[model samples]
Target: MNGSEVQFWSFVTAALLMIIGIYAIIFMDNIIKKIIGVMLIGDGVNLVLITEGFKPGGIVPIISEKLYNQSPGIFQEFADQASYSLPFALVLTNIVIGASTLAVLLGITIKLYQHYNSLSVHEIFKEEKI
Candidate 1:
């Protein structure tokens, strides 16, 4: 496939994942479904971060005097452009945070299921006093 076509598919895949997550959150009554939906949304967000980090025909941003000397103009041009590493790093951090949050939330869900003996989120909340 052509490069653009490939990129388009990549975006579409991410989008579809996000849509599925949203649907899961909206229609599913089980607490697990909500957690899965949140995870799917996180995946879609990570995909967006990856797409942003892509620089077409661009090399990794490794700065060094020797490399710069070899291609002085090229190095300057590359430096002038934005680097992908920062966004990539941020995305990685966010992924870790999302995972941690999901784990905590899932633990709470499990405890809730143990106490309630049902997977229905509405029932769990309904049993609450306020």
Candidate 2:
């Protein structure tokens, strides 16, 4: 209901998203699930970065005459250093990479399916001659 409560919930939700993503990556058998797991982890991480940038009553980092009239908080420098943009950008790059990897994996999966007429990974491996 209050600010601290909201912040606490945000962190908890972020942590849960991260945990779910890890579990999906480790335990899912399908290649698609693994890719989705990676995305879920990315979501959690992005949430954490944005959350860290939160400061109660803090203004946007834009420079304006009114803003200049106000003091940048004592932690402003640190906050600026820890801004979320870079991390978000990194996640975007990773997502693109992840998608490419998934596409390659899907191609492999499709080839296996065509050759063996089955989608089960174990079946595909059993059909392998070498």
Candidate 3:
């Protein structure tokens, strides 16, 4: 398909992921499931950001010798042809942060499970109320 169609599908997929994540976070009782939902939401957001920066027939924002040898005004052409790199960089940063956050969250969940002997949010809350 074309670039626009690809972008549309990417956005649709991201939206679906986010929706499913939200549903899981709200409806699921298990801590691990909720963590998975949070990870899904983060992934959906990253996907959307990455897709937003995508361009059809776009090249990296770097000058190459081949491009320079092709034309005298290669710099201008390169600038025009290059896709936005910021979103990709941001996504990378987000991925790292998300992974760390997930690790920390899982650690906390493990600790909670050790103390409570259960992973269910309902059970934990019910115990806390007593």
Of the candidates shown, which would achieve the greatest lDDT relative to the real structure? 3
**Local accuracy of candidate 2 as per-residue lDDT tens digits, 82-119:** 33445556666766876787788789768867887875
Misplaced by over 4 Å in model 1 are 77-83, 128-130
Which 10-residue span in candidate 1 carries the lowest summed lDDT? 75-84
TM-score order of candidates, top first: 3, 1, 2
Model 1 TM-score relative to the real fold: 0.82
Clash pairs detected, candidate 3: none
On TM-score, the stronger of 1 and 2 is 1
Q: Which residue pairs does candidate 1 place in steric collision?
A: none
Against the true structure, whose TM-score is highest? 3
Tens digits of lDDT, candidate 3, 52-113: 99998899887778868888698887789899999999999999999999999999999999
Instruction: List lDDT for all candidates, in order.
Output: 0.83, 0.69, 0.93
